[model samples]
Target: MARPRAPNRRATSCRCSWTICIEPDQGTRVKQRPGGMPPHPSQVLARRGLVTSLTWLALVAAPTVAQAQFGDPGGEGTAATDTGQIGAAALSTPRYMGADHNRLRALPYLSYRWANGWFVDGINGVGYGGSPTPGLQMGVHVGVSPDREESDDPALRGMGNVNRGAELGGFAHQRLGSWLGGKLSLRSHLRYGSGEDRQGGQAELGLGWGTRLGERSLMNLGLAANWANQGYMQTYFGVTRAQSTSSGYTEHKTDGGLRDLRLSLVVIQLFSPTTVGLLMVSQTYWQGDAADSPLVQEKRNTMAVAALMYRF
Candidate 1:
């Protein structure tokens, strides 16, 4: 009985405490919608101003991108330089570049010579054998006479025909007193035809002559000057790879005339009766003809000739 009575009281109390959860703050009065869109002018104007400012910023930035990507290299405002020479100090005359004032020279020379060619008088085989020879001729040195005969050297020497091609180099005749002398020559020749691309060799020989130039002796050496008169001059001295091509051909060529410049030494072994000896040297050609046909140019040239002359 006592337990039933307490239970009944607690049950009634629990039942009464079970109330509805009415959230008072959550059920606040709702603000009614403005009837037919009433205007807020200041807020609208502020929103409109922000949109306008944003549009202006976008428009200005669009052109700036292209200007940076497409404008000239030296920024937007500089000029180029490759306009010849510049600066006040640089605009000088052509003569200012090198030694233009000093001129070279063509010195004077004197010598007596006797050069004989049976061919000169149409006497074939008259020379070098017991054959009927052409009459020889005597003349003053028939070459560009120079001031120093003992030391002067000249005209380029080629060894073979142009069809064969040849080498180029310097040749010198050193006078070693009366009656004795020697010559120095360096040259090369090339071979024709296909397959074997061979270049030739050079020979430096010594020959002697006894002339009457008193103490100034003279000598005639072996193999003076040789030439090939083909009209074309190749850029190379040999049949180098550059010189040889499938199209590069070698042909028999001629200079029209006998292209021989005999370089010999002669003397008049006595002076009381006006003894005289002659040294006839060929020209040391520069590169080629300059003012004439098939003209060539030269680099530098040095030539000289000395003779002993005795006059009665």
Candidate 2:
């Protein structure tokens, strides 16, 4: 599976409950509340704020920790003190990008950055990351893309399984000046390794904004888009003639283009100078050729996560 990006320094967290719903024009009917009354206006705002907070938390915190240990942000090649973080995280996400169901996963949250720029973590995999110039950070790493099983969803009965494989990728993030009293940044990632053949490739680009909510809290808001090659899209979204014969879905072929768009929110709370808690929520909308695929049971996907970490 693709790993979520960690948060940066300019972000913070908030308190609220979030609800995900498709827009009226999306052709998906909204489920009414038990009383059939729409949510109050304040409730809607709160939910929106919650979403933004979670996305911001995930996007801002991680990079700041990594950069602090790798080197100073000014790219002066200064030798910084060694730092590391260890903890655990739980993630709730869709069984697959377009699956209507969800799954809960436990992940080891660990990262250590040496003064020389090399690092290992459950998030960014193993890589060397540092600011090559002021306001810019880049790195390369190797990670695993988890496999998909037909049993994951009954809808995939005869679609077969995809084996996990090694993926090679690199990432770049740049700080874009402040916006509305918050710091803004742009990030991009590209990798190869997704199908049974491990020949698929994917790319992501996003914008993140964050700010402090208080002495011990922060929040972040982000928007991102994903793209894939023909091999990757076909593997995940396409239904072959044989698959149609068995799965009872029409054969569908997918071509590469814009895949989906995502909006995320994150919130972070500090219990001590070295101990922190993070919560994040995100919504994704499938689009282009991927959306047209028969395997896509839901066009919108929601994901949530919570984690705790200690720095030493």
Candidate 3:
């Protein structure tokens, strides 16, 4: 007669014995005597939580990876493990459109790839995009607007806060082959914000080129045009009759059209297989009604960011 195997103390009493060894050579085993037994509730909950986190990470990592690829698009292959970057960025931005109080803020930068063709970029928001090897790719994304508080600027003392709200959108990218010894591309995205008083939309169009500087460095340059809808223009730039009476500004009504023209540059340096550094500079020229609003004190805006990143 064969010798009876030891019972698994972790498992409930059952007639059938199961010996599951992940690696028999290593003596790793998961033994259970219950054939019809379901996974423990804690195990099930842990698995579900892990899956949800990974999905969220993927959504945030894809855009950042795509940007780091510098138009190369070769990193989209499916993998068994998740990869991600964690970092922080120091950003210099205007308190509002024209506020003189420029604030330097440190923001967390995170991105993750749970699998091929899926990523989430914390700075750029969450989305899914195809591999860069395809030359043509599209994605859907969601982002949140920055909070506008009355305390950010003296001019905004009575304007109250433009509470941060969600923005959902889609984007498309097309590689236009090599030009100037770099990959040329066209990109566009349209986003709609959801807010009771600020539910408005904006659109962007851009042309860009990216080049590899060396074994571990890359650079990109782009020019973009931005457009806004009437609702968006009104929310940020318009002063209503009541607001004018309370804020001591003339009542102003505005129509939406061209919002701004932007020129941007990004440089990335890879310190190791798992570490990176990035710098971005962008200048915006406000146009039309956005420039004409009393809230807009400056027609030209400049922003810069420096970040250090690590991947796993």
lDDT by residue (tens digit), candidate 1, 1-312: 522321111222221211111011111011222334312111111110111111111111121110001100111011011111000101111110011121222222121111121110110101111102111111111111001111111211221223222222222222232322322222212112211122222222222333222322233232322232332112122223322332243321222111222223322121221233332222222222211222112322222223332221
Per-model lDDT: 0.19, 0.60, 0.56
Q: Over the stretch 1-312, how does candidate 3's per-residue lDDT look in tens digits?
A: 933432321323546544221121111123342566443211111110121222222222321111211221112222234566667667677667655556777767566655544666654466665434444556666666545667777887566666767777776656576676676767776768833365777777878776666544666787878888988778777778877877777778889798888777776664654455667776778889878888887788776667776556
What tens-digit string does per-residue lDDT give for candidate 2 at 42-113? Answer: 112121112222232243233110111111111112114456667776777777758898888776655666
What's the TM-score of every candidate structure? 0.19, 0.74, 0.71
Q: RMSD, each candidate, Å?
A: 48.8, 13.8, 14.6
Q: With candidate 2 superimposed using the best TM-score fit, by how many Å does residue 163's alpha carbon deviate from the native?
A: 1.0
**Candidate 2 — worst ten consecutive residues by lDDT sum?**
63-72
- Give the TM-score comparing model 1 with the true structure, all chains together: 0.19
Candidates 2 and 3: which is better by lDDT? Answer: 2
lDDT of 3 at 96: 73
Worst-scoring 10-residue span by lDDT in model 3:
41-50
